[model samples]
Target: MARYNHPEWHPLFAGYASGPTPLTTGSYGQLLYVTEFDGAPKIISEYFPEILEPAPPMLWSHAQGAEINGIGNPNEVRALTAPTFGEHLDDWNEIKISSS
Candidate 1:
């Protein structure tokens, strides 16, 4: 499973090696921090039963910005808040990423 067409979340911009489930298809709209640990990290825009409702409104991505541009995040900003990790994930947890 290797897909990366994230031109502004195009086609759900997914590159999961072995993670995202719950009918991980994607092709509607939003979906930020998607984790499959059966826990937190969820900014949905519909990822249930294959995209449904409307939970879209979580942006802020300058390719993981923060280096001279931190004024309320200015690169597709709109992410009020919903990203936390200090220990909490276990259920198919084997996070690995590479795009080079």
Candidate 2:
């Protein structure tokens, strides 16, 4: 039930936890992705009713860039393409960050 305040995507920066859901069933962050191409971010994760906030209209996030930075993703510059296993992820921004 911990929350990390991501500077770039505050408020909408979904939480990542042991499982999929965040703190509880109703207090979880949704898997969201963003690319600067069209300036329109896309919801990569399946629609979760318990999601904290519905993806906002015209909402832009640096999630993609964050992932690219964290993982050394080669496809960081492109929206449609993701590096390797990233293609399988529901949320391109979803990363297994080390709990350091």
Candidate 3:
């Protein structure tokens, strides 16, 4: 009942005209009986054919002090403005630095 945009639709529809069939009674009986039997060795062999391998160790930096060589080091870096405290004034003339 679906609409198709191309002329190739007729051949595609004829290919799948015969619908799917249900599983056989013997297949269902085998599926049920297989569970009751000791099939762990066959199941394990089929599921996992190869053994797992271990991962490689990671390399880490253990350098203590700054050593700048094109690539910037964090410890060697200095502040743009060094912090200083302003003098506390008790009187107007106490301003030693001239405002002019």
Please identify which of the two predictions, 2 or 3, would achieve the higher lDDT against the true structure.
2
Query: What tens digits encode model 3's per-residue C-alpha lDDT throughout 1-100?
Result: 1111223221110000111234321111110000112423111001110112211111112232222122111112122222121211121112112211
Give the C-alpha miss distance for residue 100 in model 2, angstroms.
18
Q: Model 3's lDDT to the true fold?
A: 0.16
Assess each prediction's global lDDT (C-alpha) against the native.
0.25, 0.30, 0.16
**lDDT winner, 1 or 3:** 1
Ranking by lDDT: 2, 1, 3
Off by over 4 Å in 1: 1-45, 48-82, 87-96
After superposition, which runs of candidate 3 have C-alpha atoms over 4 Å from their true positions? Answer: 7-21, 24-100
Cα lDDT tens digits, model 1, 1-100, are 2223343533222221212344322222232333222443333222211223222222223333212121221122221222222111111122211222
Candidate 3: pairs in clash: none
Residue 66 C-alpha lDDT in model 3: 22
The worst-scoring run of ten residues by lDDT in candidate 1 lies at 85-94
Pairs that collide in candidate 2 are none
| Residue 79 CA displacement from its true place in model 3, Å | 75
**Winning model by lDDT:** 2
Q: Residue 83: error of model 3 in Å?
A: 78
lDDT of 2 by residue, 1-100 (tens): 1122334433222323223344333222333433323455443322223333333221223433244122221221223333232222333334322212
